[model samples]
Every structure is written in C-alpha cells, then in structure tokens.
Target: MSGPWTEWDHLLKVDPDKTLVDGETFEDVCQTGTDAIAVGGTTGMTEEKMATVVEACGKYDVDLYIEPSHSNAVVHDDSLDGYLIPIVFNAGDISWVTGAHKEWARLDDDIDWARTFTEGYIVLNPDSSVAEYTQADCDLDAEEVAAYAEVAEQMFGQDIVYIEYSGMLGDPEKVAAAQNELDDATLFYGGGIHDYDSAHQMAQDADVVVVGDLVHDEGVDAVRRTVEGAKDA
Candidate 1:
C-alpha cells in the first residue's frame, strides 16, 4: 500500500501556521531541492490557508501533497498529489487514533482512498503543538517505540511509521530501534532537523527525513543543505 510518498525521500513540510521562506514563495521552496512539498500544520489549519500554499507549489514541477490536521483543513484540487494522514498511535485520547478519521470519512465523501496514505505516528515531543492537540503520550522508551512500530506495520497495516519529535531533535538510538523493528514499512523521522548533519544522521537511520520549521526559520538555502544530506546520506 505504498502511496506517492514512497517516491520521495526528502519532504519539505510547509506548516500553514508558519510563513513560507522569508522572501521566497512556495514555488521557491519546491524548486530549492526538496523532493516534494507537503502542506500541513497542527494548529490554525484551514482550507483557505492551505489552498494558498498549494496553489503556489502547484506552479512548480514538484509533487504536492497535503497532511491535513483537521477535516475542514483538507483541500481538493488538481494540484494535490495525495494526502498523508497521521494516526497518533500513542495518543492518550482515542480521538487521534480513530475518532478524527471517522469524521473525515463521514464528512468528505469525495476522498480518494487510493490517494490516501496513513502514517502511524509515535509523537514524542511533549511541548509540541501536535502532542498537545492529541494529548499524545511522550514518555515512551526505545523498547516501547519499537513495539509501537511493530504494531503499526504488522497489525495496523500502515505504510509508514513516523517517529515525531516535532519541535525537538530525535534520539538516534530510538530511531534505530524503530527501524530495526520494521521489516518493510518506510520509517519517517521528523522534528528538529535544521542542518545537514542532523538530516544526514536521521537519513542514515530512517528511510525518510521530513523537515518543516527549518524552511520557515532559516530559508531555502539551508533547506537545500538538508535535501542533499537526506538523499546523499
């Protein structure tokens, strides 16, 4: 059940809550070396705001995808390549795991299942927006993280296993543990990836490295370094 994401090794996740590259537009972000442009955010996500970013990225040749944080934030357009829906596997509240998904399915009848790819997430950033929103349990150790990864791929039939350390950098040991447990699922590591070294190291331990805040903070030249590190790692 690999989706469009399988073709991309490095994804530049543009948070709708944050501004684009200081002076550059979404088009510049796509052309700057990112394998794909993922439009999403944990808070303040709306279809109108997402559409602006999508329309900008659509101007480029890169693949465009949406990671909708809420059902109303989803946008339907020819520019969208697919949707990357994250199911918080370790969320303290059940809504993150299934309730929200049920709402999306019930509200949006036009959802193309073939274009939808679900990532089982273990959100480990206690202070991050997503963790707060979902009330995720961020206290797991390496063994627990590995177990979550196994359940995601084996029992849940997930295509990707995401270890989300949203506002902070992740531990290599934990990432390696999750990678070791997965036999075939793509491992995605995101959070605190701001430079080439971090991106390279994570890329070595995981299948993909998703960068978000970096593009918003340091701009595209810095982002290009990450793209190179992720692919050439």
Candidate 2:
C-alpha cells in the first residue's frame, strides 16, 4: 500500500501548456503545501514545454512527477520523482489504454522503470479535453464506475485508480463507489476541485485529491486552501 504517493493527500497538477496566474510563480505554487506537483496536459505538450515546467519546479523540495500525455512530451529529468503514466480504462479509442504506452516504450530508450508507475484512469467528464482527446466513454453509472475500478486494480494490477472528471465537479456518489471496490490501489480523485469544500468532499473518499486549473485561474492562495481542505478531510 505504500509508494511514492502513499502519504500524499494533495497533488497540484501543473499544465505545461498553460501559464499560472499573473505574478504567481512556480515557487509560490510549489510552496502551497501540496504533497506533490504533477506536470502534464491534454494538448499542446512537447518536450520543451514539459522541461520548462519541470525545471521551474525542480528547485523546490516537493515531489515532482510527469503525467506524460504522449511520447513526444516525455522529458527525462533528475528533478522528477516519478512518472505517473495514465492508462485510460474507459477510452472509446484503444490508443489511450495501450497504444500511447507502447509508443513511449518504443521511442524512449532511457526509461527509468524504477521511477515510473502507471495510473489507471477513468475519465468521466464528457466535456473535458482529456475525454475528447482520448475518446473516453463518460456515461457510466455508479455500478459501472466501480467495476472499472475493480478491473483496474485486480486485472491490471495498477497501483493507483484515478477517477477523473477533468473540468467539472464529479458526483461524490460515483467517487465513493469506486473507493468501495479498491482494496489497496490508491484512489485519486480530480477535476473541478476549485475550493476547500469541494476538495474536502472528494478527499473523504479518495486517498489523494488532485487539484488542477485552480492555480492557473485563482493563484496559489486558492491552492493553499484546497491543500488544507484535503489534509483536513
């Protein structure tokens, strides 16, 4: 049950393709008490962009990770604590599930297996860019969601099961459903966690609450509040 993410209660996801709130630097964001910083995006991701964010956050002491969307965007850096490669469980297109991972293995000869792990992702937001890009099936009921979580843990042997509602708030009932099925795989909940209450609500069931887009929109102050919320839960 213990790994790089075992003690993590909050994760601040930084999109390489987007800018942070005006005047707020990576230093500010990194010091927000988030357990880790996840660098990635659904689109416009390249090695240069990934490196930019990684380097900025590298100066800090917090754990840093790359959630590579594709092989082209993967950056090898000593600053990264690990790679949280996402395998979309409900992707309508098979590429999100296996094709992208295969391509990364083929293209990158220097993969650090010791510092890499897979995240079983169930993208459940119909309007999110990740959903559209991966062609994810987002109309599942609570039972269906739990089944995916079960398969991700039991069949795939994933260390983490992520319930992602990319841009909007997700149903707490569905998140709890996924939690009920997992025995050891850490449950991560993300999307629409813009404030303290939303973060607390999701953190109650999810082992780690991931916050993205909030820092870009509201700055580090808002991010600090969510960190408190997640820890408080």
Candidate 3:
C-alpha cells in the first residue's frame, strides 16, 4: 500500500520498436488516457532501448513502472516509480521461485519492490514458446489454477495476482477463474488483447488489462481506441 502502487487503472505496455519512433513518444503514449505506463518486453530488451523508453516516458505526468525481463535487464534510475516482477509460481520449478530472485538481489541498486506481483503464469496446455522455453509444466485445469492462486496469496503474501497467458492470446475464462479464486489480490490480465471489446471482456474481472502488442504494431490511434474502449466498458 505504501510504495509505488498509490493508484491503479488501465496500463499501457511498451513494445520495443528500436528502429521506429512512436509518433506519440512518451507524451503521446501517456496522452492516450492510460493510467500508467509499463515498460518492458519478454525478449530483445536492451539497456539502451529500456533507457530511451523510460526517459521518453518521464516527460509525461503519469506514474511509470518497469517489468524487468530479468535482474540484468532492470535499469534502476531516479525516474522509475517501482518494479513489477512477475513471479511465475505455477511453473512447477524452483528456478523461477527463489533462484531468479537471488540473482536480482545482487544488483548494484536496491529494488524498490512496491508489491510482489504473483502470477498464475499459466501456459496453455497446447503450449506457447514462453512456457516451453522456461520449461514450465503448465498442464493445469481450473482447480489447480485456483489452488495456485491461493498459495500465491497466502504463502507468498502477494498483493497482486496475475493470470497471465504469455506470448499468445489470453483466455478470458482462465483469467476470470483465477480472479474468482483469489482474495484481496489485485487481478491482472494480459496478452493478445487487440480491441476494446476484447479488452472489455478481459476487464470484467481483472483490475488491470494490459495491452502491449497492439501498441507496438498499431500506434497511438490504437492505444486511444483501446483505452477508450476499456474505460467505457
């Protein structure tokens, strides 16, 4: 409650288009009526790219956060509000459990951990590249997902519980399932949310609807459309 999460609403996730310039820039992205700006990508995140994006975002008045792909990727600067580290507890491996965190602690800067964002991090049974590459054993039914949510809240003491469908489109049922099963945890949904209607459906139970790829591919107009759709929903 005290750290960087003083307020919350729809978030706009930044995409890494190094060769391109967002006609909007930080001012433009923030102007799209988003509550906050999330800066990070699962892959191809260079320090230079991260710095440029964060610096650009600083010109805007909205609160800013970074989703570090890993410990090395986190570039701590005075402008950042805090970090949103996704803990994939259901990965069925301890590597993402404590091993990954231990590595991050060695960073030169101290982590301004606002809230431990615990995610169900479910990889669809058919399999996505993220699950396969991370070696996540994500063959879970709704029951298992709910159980994971409970543990993530009680055992891990997480303030935010995210139902993530990484690298592919999200399933509304899956996200709603996890949201229903948890208690006192801020619910979040992300992945493949392209339009306002889809964003609305995803936002039904989610406290935050993250739109990343759309911003990367479509541009500011897309961000405005999506944010308007989400707010009106």
Candidate 4:
C-alpha cells in the first residue's frame, strides 16, 4: 500500500564515505521536505551501512524504510519503516517479490511494517545495476510495459506500478504511457530524473516522483527544490 502521497528515497551509492548523509546526520537533512525516508541501493549496501542509515533516519523521527537489494539484506529490526518488494511476472522471479514477505514474521526481530508496497518494476535502462542484479529482460517496448502496468494493480493488487528507468536519465514517454494504462494504482517514476523539469514531467503523470541520487549529489536543499517543483506540478 502507499504510505504517503510524497516520499523521499534517501539512498546513497553504496559506499559509506561516498554517502551524502552519514547514519547520524540524516535527521535535519531529512526534515526539509521528507514525508518519508526510504533506504537501500544497488551498490555497497552492507547491512551495517543500512543499519547506520536506518538508525540515522530514525534519529530524525521521519518514516524510515528500506528497499532491500535482496531477500537476505533485510534487517529484522526496529529501525525500518517497511519494505518495497519488486514483483515482475515477466521476469519469472518471485524471491524479492513475495518470498521476502512469506518469512518476514519468522525473522529474529519483530518487524513493525507500516505497509508492504507491491510494485511492478519496469527496468528501462539497459546497463543499470538493478537490471543486471535481477537479470531482468529489458526490451523497452511501450505495449510490453502497458500490459504489465495494466495487470499490476488489478491482478496483483499492487499499491504502486513503477515505470522506472535507472541510470542518469529515465524515459518519460514510457512512464507516461504506463501511467495512462494503469488501473487504480499509484504510479511511481524514478531514476534518470536529475532536475525539476524532468521530474515535473514524470510527476505530471505519476502519483509520485522518486528522486534519490539527486539528493545525494545536489544536497537536501536542492532536492527540496525538486520536491517543491513536483508538488506544484
């Protein structure tokens, strides 16, 4: 389910030293325009680093969550908001999709999940890490994605259907097309959105525009601009 209308993916590029906000320094940074904070990335997301970042967001009192890289990367602890599991029937993979949820209750810690957001992830960027990691078949076809978007909400009851194109630039045309085809689900668009103009275009069609690397590179204040632009859009 969708937790809030607006959310922030406060993610960094795996390496801690390259991290924009350290584990203990995310409170004030997170308060600027953060309705919620989501942790996790495609790279060096060591469990320790994830814990550190989660704990840091916890310090800020913002809604803290993680988009785990894999099933085993989850921290069965109290510092997280919940998890967003990517489920793509096209890929024929279900581990990161529903498998993680099946065994969540049996973990060491009593995970306080706010909501489990089911997403039909669209991998548009060919050489993206997420594509490689998941071994997703990325053919960048509009009709292909439209069909998936059509079923994601009604069939799977997904909270969101994400039209994502990772790397430096996302495809707005594909995202817009998918947005038009979806049922009663919140459409989320991320990746390749580095500026307000691109973000606004994507935001125009989707329910939410998630710009993570923008904050990491441009700082919280700059991200705030994107957030403001998105809201105004």
Candidate 5:
C-alpha cells in the first residue's frame, strides 16, 4: 500500500502489437485518463517494439511502466517509470514462476529493485497467450485463489496480486476472495473489461482494475469511459 504502485487504482495496459494493428497511436491512448499505462504483451514481444511504445508514452506526464513477458522483450529506457514483472502463481511450468526471473537478473544489470514491482498473477484464461505460454492453472475455485493471494502477500512479499482472466471476463467473487485474503498488498484484476459496467464492477472487487484489448478494439473513447467507471467505483 506504500510504494511506486500505491497510487495506481486504475491502469490501462496497451499491447504494442494490438495498438499498431488497430491503427491508433500511443500518444492518443496515453491521454485516456488512466492512472497509469502498462506496456507489454504475451506474443510478438521485442525490445524494439516496446521501445517505440515507450517513446510515445514518454511524451505524456502519466506514469508509464513495462510489463515484460520474456527477458528478450525487456527494454532499457530512463523515461519509463519502472518495471512490473509477473510471477504466475498457478503456472503449470515452474519457469514462469522463477526461472525467467533468474535469467533476467543475470542478463540485465540495470534492474533497479527500488523501482521494480512484482505482480503475483493467477491467470484464468485457458486460451490466452499468457495462459498458453505459462501453462496456467485456471481451474481453481474462489477459496483456492484466495489461498494463493495470501501466499503471494505473506510468503513472497509480493507488491501486487493480480487476478488475470485475460480473454475472458473475470469472476467478481474470486476477485473479492483474493482482496479479502490480502492485507496490505495491492490487488489488481484484469480481463474482459471493455466497458464502464465491467470495469466498475471489477474496481469494486479489487484495489486496481486493469483494462487491455478494450482500447485496441474499441478505441480510446471506450477506454476513457472505463477509466471514469474505475475511478467512480
């Protein structure tokens, strides 16, 4: 509750691939009224592509962060606020939990721990790129998801606990269960949030609601509405 991410109650995650595909620029999306902007994606990720997006977002005064899916996709830029790396808690592959972390630390010497934040993710999309890459365990019940959240906060000392439903809409009861289990750690819920109502509902359940794909598919106007809903929630 007291760190670089403490103020981010509503975030808009923009995937560079999708943004460019939708024919919208990052400068326009950065002004969508979100508390922060997270740049990253599960597929087709590269340092060059990330740098392009970061450079555009740097023009804005908003907090800009990178959520790198792999070590190869990480970008080194002073303009970026920091990194938001994910540790998939229910990943079927152990590599997603810790193996990649060790590799990144070994490869990159510029990782400032003070500016870094780790998000413990319970990915719940069976068909998402993240789910496919991490081999996520998406069959857990609400109670079980809550247990993972507790472990992330107490054992791992995670700064953020993310319930990621990805391509599918999330279950509010599951989000609430994780929120109830966590004490000080920030809870972030992402997935299927394309409009005001869904974003508002998720905002009520978690400390932060992350909207992705919506901005690419529906444009910044739709993303702005979600930002309003999240803040007003």
Candidate 6:
C-alpha cells in the first residue's frame, strides 16, 4: 500500500494483441480518468506488439505500466512508470510462479528493481486464457481464497493481491473474503467489468478495479463510466 499504485482506484488494461474499438485512440482511452494504463495480454504477445501499444499510450499524461506475460514481450521505455510482474500462486506449473521470473532476472541486468513490483495472483476463472496458459487451479471456495490472500501478504510478502477472474465477473463474496484477509496488500479485481454496476460492485471490496475488454469491446466511453464507478465506490 505504499507506491505509485497505492492511490490507484482504477486501471485500464490494454491488450497488445487486440485493437481498440474503431475510431477510438490510445489518447481517448488514456484521457478517460483511469488512474493508470497497464499494457499486457495472455497470448500472442511479442516485443513489437508491446512497443506499439506502449508508444501510443506514452503520449498521454497518465501512469503507464507494462504487465509482461513473457520475457520476450517486455518493452522498456522511458515513459513507463513501472512493471507489474504477475506471480500466479495457483499455477499448476512452476514457470508461471517463479521459473520465468528467475530466468528473466538472470539474463536481464538492466532491470530497474525499484520500479518493479510483484503482483501475487489468484486466477479464479477456469475458462480464461490466463488460467489455461498457466494451468492455474481456479476451483477454490471463499475460504480458500482468503487463505491465498493471507499467504500472499504474510508468506510471500507481496504488496498486491490480485483476484483475476479474467473473462467473467467474479463473486463479490469471494472478493470480500480475500479483502478481509489483507491488512496492507492492495487488492486488485479484474474481470468482466463491462459497465458501472459491475465496476462498482468489485470496487467495493477491491483496492483497484481494472477494466480490460471493456475498452476494446465497448470503446472509451464505456471505460470512462467504469473509471467513475471505481473511483466513486
């Protein structure tokens, strides 16, 4: 709860592999009053694609972050405020938890440790691309979700605990269970936040409500409403 993201109540996640709604530009998305913009995707991510989105987003006066899915897709730019590295606590494979991170750290000496922070993730959607790619266990109940949150903050010492449902809206009870366990770690909720009510519901328990497909599917105006919903919560 003590960094640039501490005050962020809303974030717009742009997938490099996907295009924005027709006639909508990065400028439009960035000006929607979201606390920040996070660039990332689960699949088909490449350095070229990442750079394209980052360059476009860097033009606006907003906090810009790269949520790198793989080492090769990472884009280093002066405009970037930080890197939000995901460590999936429920991934069946070790690679998504720490293996890839170790490899990235070993090969890259230019890493800015100060600007990089780890997000302990609990992927809770069995149908999502991230769960499929990482082989994450997504069948946990509310109590189990709370245990993971406790482990993320007390055991792993992660500053952020993300409940990622990805393509669908998550259960608010489960999100609240996780929130109850966290004393300091920022709780981030991202999934099917397509409108104001969905965003506000999740924002009630989450420290930050992140909207992804909303911008690409519904455009900037939809994202603007979500920003208001999250902040207003």
lDDT of each: 0.90, 0.95, 0.70, 0.65, 0.89, 0.94
TM-score of each: 0.97, 0.99, 0.87, 0.82, 0.96, 0.98
Which is superior by lDDT, 1 or 4? 1
Q: Mind giving the per-residue lDDT tens digits that candidate 5 earns over 1-233?
A: 47666677789898877654366677778888898999999898988888888998988889999999889888878888889999999999999999999999999988888778889999987889899899988898999999999999999999799999998888999999999999899999999998889889999978888999888788988998999888889
Best by lDDT: 2
- Residue lDDT tens for model 4, 114-135: 5556567877766877777666
Task: Give Cα distance to truth, residue 109, candidate 4, Å.
Answer: 7.2
Q: Count the clashes in each prediction.
A: 0, 0, 0, 2, 0, 0
Task: Report the C-alpha displacement of residue 222, candidate 5, in angstroms.
Answer: 0.4
- Clashing pairs for model 4 are 64-81, 169-192
* TM-score between model 3 and native: 0.87
Global local distance difference test of model 2: 0.95
* Candidate no. 4 TM-score: 0.82
Residue 181 miss distance in model 1 (angstroms): 0.7
Report the C-alpha lDDT of model 2 over 87-181, residue by residue, as the tens digit.
99999999999899999999999999999999999999999999999999999999999999999999999889999998999999999999999
Scanning candidate 6 in windows of ten residues, the lowest lDDT window is 1-10
Model 3 RMSD in angstroms: 2.6
Q: Please say which candidate is ahead in lDDT: 5 or 6.
A: 6
Record all residue pairs in model 5 with backbone atoms less than 3 Å apart, i.e. clashing.
Answer: none
- How many pairs of residues in model 3 come into backbone collision? 0
Candidate 4: lDDT over CA atoms? 0.65
Clashes of 1: 0
Off by over 4 Å in 1: none
Model 3 misplaced stretches (Cα beyond 4 Å): 2-7, 17-22, 113-120, 123-129
The C-alpha RMSD of each candidate to the native structure, in angstroms, is 1.1, 0.8, 2.6, 3.5, 1.3, 0.9
